[model samples]
Target: MLLKQMTAAALAAALSLFLSGSVTAAAEEHYDVYHYDCWSEAVPSQAGYTAERAVSGQDLGVGNFSEPTDIFRDSHDRFYIVDSGNDRIVVTDAELETVEKVFDTFTMPDGSETALNSPQGVYVAPETELLYIADYDNSRVLISDYDGNVQREITKPDSELFSQELTFLPQKVLADKAGNVYIVLGNITTGAAMFSSDGVFQGYYGANTVQTTPEVIVNHFRKLLSTDEMRSRQARTVPSGITNFDLDDEGFIYTCSQSTSQTQDTVKKLNAAGANLFSSLGVTWGDIRSYYDTNTNTNYQPMICDIEISDDKSINCLDLTTGRVFQYDKEGSLLFIFGSKSDQLGGFTEVTALESCGESIYVVDKRKNTVTVFAETDFGSLVHKATELYNAGYYEEALAPWYQVLQYDGNYVRAYEGIASGLLVKGDYEGSMRYAKLADSNSRYNKAFEGYRQEWLSAHFTQVAIVVILVAAVLTGLHFYRKKHIAKTETAERSEQP
Candidate 1:
């Protein structure tokens, strides 16, 4: 009874926090915070993206959706909504207004029919027009052509690479250009389960590292002192499980691991060899610290639930706790952050997935059973143009767009850095230094200072040399005259004494 009472009290406290945060957010309705650097925060003068509209079940002509899980937009711009609760997939046109087709049954090759069991994820291969579904209850990956004919089914591997004792439930899945399939299993802490095109289980790919704490280190020492039998009973640390993943146009798989306790490598770009190119740049993937909400007096750690990679290499990570989608450029610089947790149109109850179309972003709300589309604002366009040029090393050419970004949001730190880089390239060191200071880029400021100092020295070298020569000659003449005067005085005194 005491334990139950304590649990109830804890739940109530958590509910209070959520209610307070939602109330404050609804009252203000501002999604303006962007992380500039590890220690700095900036608010845009204008919202980068705004929720233009929401598409619910009523719009899909499907009465009402219960716990819709995933949303995907294929190359042909067709929208695929995985209606998990209904045990079916809803297909819509590019405009998302008309329902094109509904996938409820799969036609098997052996003159039989099978149905999906609470599919959580759906992926349509852009080239081959293949559909991959993670049938949760069925514990298999269902692959079919656009016509709903089951081409192949991926069950648990029969090889020793897979553990027979463990369940093979897949939550999310994606396919690469080479027909390689990757599935994110919820209970697998190793990584996403990888398989070849022939349905052969290869191995786990891109596993997160174990977060080392003081307790972990102590346990390691304790194991060294214990017997083998005792060591077997000790707890073994493991990597966090990957939640969801999406494939970019270039075939790199971008994944998100929803672990609030582990901060490192929450989002990653894994190459064909399963190496994380994101961490190779030595930068953090998301916000450096947990966001502190003053209204709720709570520190909301970022739990990245989903990732969407754009054609421009922009990575969008959806945070479940704050309902904010943190978007980063190709090189890991934060582009913009927008969203909130509320019952309003632009807000989200639960952010389950994110999908990127050309100029808009679609976020699926599991609780609301709707997908909210966010259209890019003029500010967002300017920011993207500037960031694209900046990341491409076209600093001078990016000046116009970067300045245009300032016109929209003067607080944008990247714009200042972009302008500074342009000025530095144009040999305007003083201007570069000024902008770099505003951007808080110490390396840029130092380089600009060095250039300014060198220019100053070069411009005044001749004048400085002439002054030095004149001072030396004057000193020598004064010394000789003083010596002659002393000698003459000595001669006169000697004559008088004689």
Candidate 2:
């Protein structure tokens, strides 16, 4: 009886240990983290950002979020979540631990009471401390204060520039420092509707240009040759409209377009003139290669649904197609990619919006009715420190951090590039070239080679000069000796002939 009892105890202990180990392994493999190399190949990397926790409205004691479509973080570190299904906006503290306010009803300027009708988007202007809500079903944008007092109600423009046949359905809204409000409509493909602070429709803002492909070029020529009636019968093609946008502190607007076939202008960084500053970079916004699902036998392209620019100018793009977050630097170099479409804790079922605060990223899943918080790991922090220093023209100061990044992720190509740049700035051209080669940065490698050549010449300048001088003196002596010997031989021959 004693032996049987002892065996039972041993089996229980072993079973518990096995279960714990399995859980730890599963947690670590919840999601994959990688970055693209210069060749546009996905390179496995350490997790730069890991899912810390998923926060629901229930967790904050504000009831569960019902189909939250958008999330915005104001300058005051407050978060505003647009609960579309609930027809309200839930405001929370920076940590998302406590509920601050919930906006569902408001008082109109004329002392009339009103309520939000399926508000899809929300933004709080730092300058005016006012809330901008995109009232989807209501066909208007409501500007109100924290107390839910409606200051202005902007509806569809009655001007001829806007088509009267179209319905006024606003999806997203944002205001610039100049108080110019830009709104993304559901049907208008021209661009985001722009309005002045005084509630006057100015015009369209940043508009995407249609991609000129071979098929488009052919269709254009065919239409020109066809008669008016034939041209009218032909199908027309228009540019994909901007789906969402965000504004940075510098007043620059970043827009994202959700399209599977269009890759030209999936993401745009627009200036005040509404010109795309990122066009010249020729960089792909999301995954470089199409993702193939073995289970479904289908290939999926990145459909960027939302974009968030961090304080350090890192662009975090949320891809709805793959439910992955692609984070890039200011120069459009990919830093990290994480998340997936799964029922797992780290994975997102339907990612709708993303926002960055400090070193953490918050992504909202509409179907899941929760916001997953991703906190930067030590590897991510090191990479960010190096990137910040390198971008700020402090290459020498970034060297140590970049090296430390390599210790964590040896396959991190950005770390190699950063190290190469730092080495070049520190006058270690040879080392720079080596690292540049590893990073596949031909331009950096060429520059380093040139610097190395110049340095080598400068170091051996005396030896090179002395060798040139000695060679010249020896040649001159040989010339003189040959001329004298020829003359003496000619004289001896003449004397012998006489």
* Alpha carbon lDDT of each predicted model: 0.86, 0.91
lDDT top scorer: 2
- Tens digit of lDDT per residue, candidate 1, span 1-498? 999999999999999999999854432434554545424644434567888889998887976777888999988889899989999999988888889889989998786999989999999988789999999999999999988899999998897877889999999999888898999997889898989998999999988888787777898899889999998898887778988898887777888889866777888888878788888676555565667999999888888999998878898999998898888898888887888888888899988988888889999999999989888877788899889888989999999999988876678888999999999998999999999999989999999999999999899999989999999999999999999999999999999997
lDDT of 2: 0.91
Name the lDDT value of residue 446 in candidate 2: 94
TM-score of each: 0.86, 0.89
By summed lDDT, the worst window of 10 consecutive residues in model 2 runs over: 23-32
Per-residue CA lDDT of model 2 for 159-196, tens digit only, reads 88999999999999999998889999989888899999
Which regions of candidate 2 deviate over 4 angstroms? 1-29, 294-297, 466-498
Best by TM-score: 2
lDDT, model 2, position 261:
64
